[model samples]
Target: MDLIRQARARLAARLVVVTGASSGIGRAFVEAMAPSGARFVLVARRRELLEQLADHVRDSGSHAMVQALDLRDVEAGRAAAEEVLAHHGIPEVLFSNAGHSIARGLRGLVARPDSVTRSVAANFTGPVCHALPLLGAMCTRGGGHFIATTTVDARTSVPGWSPNVASKAGWDAWARSVAPELRSDGVATSLLAFPLVATPMLPPARRARARCAMSPEAAAEWVARAVVTRQARVAPWWLRPHELLHAAAPVLTARVTAPFSMRLVDRG
Candidate 1:
């Protein structure tokens, strides 16, 4: 057990790129892996927070490279990927965890096309924009690990989360379809179906329902464990039952979840 633990830590402590590194799960992942002496490329829009995390990573005796940019911009995401490749070389791991959510009903989302656009760009287009170049480089090198943070909403398509659900569903589908193809190129892909984690992304009411939600730190540790164990899917054990239920009866599952998800709607 100790050997396995040590090995996991060592494996996690390698050159890696993590998007959305400023806070929540991204920050926790950095903190959790720092002790293993992991070198990190922290990508996020917040310069100050990225610097703070870089300092924290450096303090832990690891190298930290900061790329402060919004992943929603395809040009910028590509530039950041290029810069990282130029300086740090291709990372052994790419954690495409950056995302955005809209707690608005479909009517509300339709009322403001701009919000829907941004949400889609952030949750779906952004990761792919940043990842394609990086993944190509990894394939050239003969191996790499790609971890994408997804959600149960993708499967259930809960109300008041149209943008979030659709965007993640697209991302999730892309990862699943490509995982097998990527494997032939020696690249491994993981689509992590996260049940609500207590992160800044969630509204106050949602965060209060703590039974099903994992702490960001716990989620981060789980991600690291997946990387170490080479697991293609990283999710809480409790989520399995929910997944099975959805698989067996998606419409019924959606009906059951609708009322609770409606609470997330921005009625105003």
Candidate 2:
């Protein structure tokens, strides 16, 4: 079978939970997979947007349930996870695709420490909190796939992106650390280390300047590929080499890139 058919076969009538489903790549992924006959649990902060997407999914003859809440709230995330489990049973595929980003230097970070908390909540604690319940249930059931949408930036640190990179890196590390254990339980984990994508997550100026970035729909294709293939990671070809360079000479790499990174931030 072709990839599309394979994906459809795998996901057909299965329950798939997707965070950040109101917009961007998450929304696109839901739309792309709707034709596969999957039932989706859409989690995001915006009720209206989630409702609209749910309408679209129902129109396409798929099942959709929207859980609208801010992932930044740890309690809310936990509660939402339990609610999803109670309502939908354990999802066959849990796409943990929600994240938040903030660009701030040490000075700015010091001035606004809440940025760090917010970033950590959105990218690390929140997602983990939300996934823990489902993960346990999935393990009990003995077969599932967990896909995390991380960033290529998590591979290497950059100036002015500490909050974003650090939080994403934490999530990436957590997912990798749990992968072997999850595998033993017949649960697979895949991480998508994505490059810049044309989404609302990017600043307007950066989005406009991001000529090489993939579109949201294109990014969704990567997620679908992960769902179909269950690969450990999906990333740009150059990312591994870039990561090696940073690992080999962290100080030198940081020093060399700091100016350019700051310049971009200033421009943004």
What are the clash counts of all predictions, listed in order?
A: 0, 0
Ten-residue region with minimum lDDT total, candidate 1: 1-10
Question: Tens-digit lDDT track for model 2 on 39-145?
Answer: 99999999999999999999988899999999988899999999988887889999999997788888787778888898999999999999999999999999999
TM-score of each: 0.92, 0.96
- Alpha carbon lDDT of residue 43, candidate 1? 94
Q: Give the true-structure RMSD of model 1.
A: 2.3
Candidate 1 C-alpha error for residue 102, in Å? 1.0
- 10 residues in a row with least lDDT, candidate 2: 259-268
What's the distance in Å from true for residue 159, model 1? Answer: 1.3
Best by lDDT: 2
lDDT of 1 at 237: 71
Q: Where is model 2 more than 4 Å wrong at Cα?
A: 264-268
Clashing pairs in 2: none
